[model samples]
Target: MTETDPVTAAPSGKGLDARLVVRRGSFRLDVELSAAPGDVVALLGPNGAGKTTALRALAGLTPLSEGGRLWLDGVRLDRTPPESRPVGVVFQDYLLFPHLSALDNIAFGPRCRGVPKAEARTQAAAWLERMGLAEFAGTRPRRLSGGQAQRVAVARALATRPRLLLLDEPLAALDARTRLDVRAQLRHHLADFEAVAVLVTHDPLDAMVLADRLVVVEDGRVVQEGGPSDIARGPRTDYIAQLVGLNLYRGEAEGHTVRLEAGPAITTTERLDGPVFVAFPPGAVTLHRDRPSGSSARNLWQCRVAGLETHGDQIRVDLTGELPLAADLTTVATAELGLRPGSSVWATVKAAQTHAYPA
Candidate 1:
């Protein structure tokens, strides 16, 4: 649906309900979101999809257009200033002050809110202990590791005692090993938080691990939203399909046969009719240099290799022919078949391996 179209959900007993609309030249963004207390929601999409803009609107960093409204705990917040709102934000880069000690950095927010300096430092000490960074409290930002810096940033945000917490790519700067440890730690902290938390991220794994709900936005509109498992198992768009490593097709179904809009037909075990979707993992696809005559697979197509890439231990071959598809094969099989770009191949998939659901 278009962004201007009304999209809503039943409000929970208490939390956040925001309707944001912002116009920049010819571009416009409109979205409605709701979350109950203790709820964590992740806004996930590609770059330039308005995910960050929505977060900025909630944080009061960006002014809303006419007719926009923001509410938290039954109080209006649309016109409130960022510093005045009961909101806390951890930016993408963490944005820790270079010259301030870790302890001072966490204490700054509370101190600015009129808390006594000694009391603020005491609270900062407690937060640092909670984040397992007490040993580094005296160190500056430049001396802390990526994970340590992120924890300090989170502690700083929490010190404000905000009713709404916002995070933008909270773990984007960490290395792979550090990301795992910090992500687990962050999940624990978020669980203990009693307020509503909204995070902006482009990574699906981060969304699934850190948030209770996923809102998939595209081109300034929310295209799909649900629990992580539901979104992964039943992706509605090609972008999601690619994210979850599944090949997807849209088609008109008649009984068990689904005729694809692009071309060819897929035989599925599901007894669906009318408009439908068919999806299968790349691993379920088998590729061969020559088509087998006695194969039991119900779907087979002649395809040419369009591209190839390594996916962990296996090789993923992109193909184009009757159906644009991706097939995952072992390195041994790839070498034996001389697979490469421009190579001709036959791909087959069993009906039992394909899943079909109503669109």
Candidate 2:
């Protein structure tokens, strides 16, 4: 399914339905969003696209300008105060008090919600154990690692027993190595969360791994929304395509005939009709500075090498062809070809390496 596809959900009287309209100067955030119980939705976009603003609106940190509505399980909470709302928010920076222990940090929310101090601590302890942070419960935020702080933040949010959880760039603070481990850990916990979860992230990998659906906001408006795999497979906008960096094409496929809208047509292995998506990985494309003498490859486009960059030992050549595509070349091959920016080149991509699916 594509981003335009309608999502299905189990019948929930009112899980979380909100129309958030916030205006700052001339900039406006007008987003209509809904999620059923047990739904994990990710609000994904680049910086300054209002992903954070939307999350804040749902958490009641920002009031809407042109009227707003927020419902939680049939209850209209727009009129409710922030403290009275059942929403739980974990900020990008784990805002744990420096003086407080990891255990106390997790207990703070429940304590503020009127739970007994001892009971809240007990609850916090259980959550800490679940998050694999029980060993560091006595450690303060200043001493905790980035990944540890993130897990504690999550435990705090979940300890509130909220019907809706809001996570803002939960994994953005960790390094690459830590991110890999934390992402796996976070996915398991999110899967076990019984309530609706909405996370704001710019990382495609985080959105794809952590959530069931992605709601892409651009300049305060929802531009694309869909399941992660589908969006990865068929990106409608150039930004999405560039984010995933895949060669995307929109065309009609009848049986095995796949017509390219921008360049030469080709036959595909899939049988389809109407709107379809064709995608090819960057590594599948072969870059040549000269036009092919003779090749069995079905698709070849004469183009110019727009840019060259090194990814580890492999050189990634960006080609502006009859259609632009990214091609991966070895360091030795790049040195031998002497490929550079503005250099003429030819790109050859095998038909079997290209993939087509319903858009």
Candidate 3:
């Protein structure tokens, strides 16, 4: 990708365009991101990968060291203060003031921007109604449920009429049930948002459901980015592979065979050569106690079970030997085989079940 100078990039566009570089001590964060109007972009990564720092820089809460510029809807905001920028941020914890009523919390943003008290209250009331929290308008943060508090937080950010919206781990604070309900509601709200929206999340499900595009960041840099389905189908890094639940291996290929540097040769149906990647789902793997005769599976390796754990209705067995693999078996099959940790087993997968692509 060609790197564009953020400072010189034109701001007269429909969305946000930014290049951020932040340095503190020896750590540095560098990333380029863009989103069109009505687009929700998600920054996803592991812990301490600078996803939050990137969001802060975009919100003007964190200053950039150098090579940083921010533009939204034809306005340059690199030098703007956090309060002055047309940006709104919803924090991970939904930092609602304990002393303020829900209506007051939503109205606070507009009031801070110099709107009259009556007008701010009116706008806040409308937002509460839109969020389906009109009845809870007078309730304090302490009385609201987790999902309600999150909605109030989102409403507070939207009440400011920001051109750029940022949400940092918006659903991380909710319980499983609350997260499911709130995620649906947030998706609806984001769909109606007219400006650019960017959210930081480590949850792959949240990112897939809420964002139009996924930006996978690691070690303060963007490693992969694309539509959610594309990223899910073709993960570029092991972190992403783990998120998508695929057993990915990088290897050198010659036609229909790939030789893993880690000491395994996988046969694939795809006609690929040079550097390649082969991936298969855990369910595609079958484990056996004794080598089977007259089996059609092209790939077989003897492995010792490293661990075993429940995966929903199935048991996931982690094996390490010639190849490190994860195999998902039914509970009945696992019980029949008496599978346990450190048990020697054979794993097999057909070439037709394995997917190979250029690395």
Better of 1 and 3 by lDDT: 3
| lDDT, each prediction | 0.92, 0.84, 0.93
Give all candidate RMSDs, comma-separated. 3.4, 4.9, 2.2
Model 1 lDDT tens row, 34-55:
8998999999888898999999
Highest TM-score against the true fold, candidate = 3
Number of clashing residue pairs, candidate 1: 0
Give the TM-score (vs. native) of candidate 2.
0.88
Q: Write the per-residue lDDT of candidate 2 for residues 16-86, one digit (tens) a residue.
A: 87878889987888888888888999998878888888888888888866556677787776667889889
- Give the residue spans of candidate 1 off by over 4 A: 1-12
Candidate 2 at residue 307, lDDT? 88
Candidate 1, position 78, lDDT: 81
Alpha-carbon shift of residue 28 in model 2 (angstroms): 3.0
Candidates in order, TM-scores: namely: 0.95, 0.88, 0.96
Candidates by TM-score, descending order: 3, 1, 2
